[model samples]
Target: MMLFGHGDGGGGPSPAMIESLRIMQKNVPGLPDVVADTPERFFKHAASRYSGLPRWVGELYFELHRGTYTSQAMVKKGNRKAELSLRKADLLIGVFAQFRILHQNAA
Candidate 1:
């Protein structure tokens, strides 16, 4: 799986890169099949061919962005606080909705 494009900066495969792939498609001797395909299709084909591929059952920590785990402390804190706030808001909304329904029924 040769990912040919601008890494991280995101300018995706240039016309020249695409043209090069098109030119080299099935032309290179001793090389495996060289066909441009979506990641989904590639994975599907791989799964079908290699059924014994190891399955990952846990969180996939990005090895490339390991620094984020230590550097984004404030971001993680803010996200947790936001989540808690949303949960509290949901609880209050549900309580008020129930109360309103009871009051309406009583009236």
Candidate 2:
């Protein structure tokens, strides 16, 4: 998958964000190989292969800074829920490890 971010730091996307995307694609199963490039590079690539392309590719805009002071309660609740989920995941991991060890010993 080719994800076009404004390359060379033209846009707000930092190098760390690009690297994180690469790492996620690498570690995740069934995820396509991701290539992060500038808009100019993607446009050039599309132009070179114009015949096989669609009429238009959609655009997305993200507002990184939004005033959310009113949603503090919601944010806190979400954080609490996430913490509970992580605790549950930790417990499951411990159980899985114990099971694995037991199975190995039995074998």
Candidate 3:
């Protein structure tokens, strides 16, 4: 019985990681089911949570208006010190909605 991440170097699942997957599924069932078994999932799920994406995914959303980013790679890998904080996905979605409306004149 191979787990989803067996191809990698035997990385065990983090509870936080699994929770991210569940959150993703609950909100965006239409996208491909990608679990937190790899860096791609971590980046994507974090991106979704942080970025103000409107039912859309990919690089373009990262560059678009209303999108804010907290790069996991930088926080995890870089030397910059910053406070660790995050808004839940539901709150972020509402915030994004507001951002879209407020910034409609600029966008």
Best by TM-score: 1
Model 1 lDDT tens row, 1-107: 88999865688999999998987795688877688889999989999999999978887767788676588899999999999999998888789888774444544
Please, what is the TM-score per model? Answer: 0.50, 0.34, 0.23
- Could you tell me how far off, in angstroms, the CA of residue 102 lies in candidate 1 after the best superposition? 94
* Total backbone collisions for each predicted model: 0, 0, 0
lDDT of 2 by residue, 1-107 (tens): 34545753558656887678868767577876666667888789877988676665565544653444455778878998999999998888789888774444544
Backbone clashes (count) for model 2: 0
The reply for model 3, stretches above 4 Å from the true place, is 1-9, 29-107
Task: Evaluate residue 93 in candidate 2 and report its C-alpha lDDT on the 0 to 100 scale.
Answer: 71
Estimate candidate 1's alpha-carbon lDDT, on a 0 to 1 scale. 0.84
lDDT of each: 0.84, 0.70, 0.56
Supply candidate 2's per-residue lDDT for 84. 100
Alpha-carbon runs more than 4 Å astray in model 1: 57-107
- Model 3 per-residue lDDT tens digits across residues 1-107: 11443234587667775676677766585876544355667767777887975555556543443323444556554433332233354566688788764444645
Error of 2 at 89 (Å): 1.7
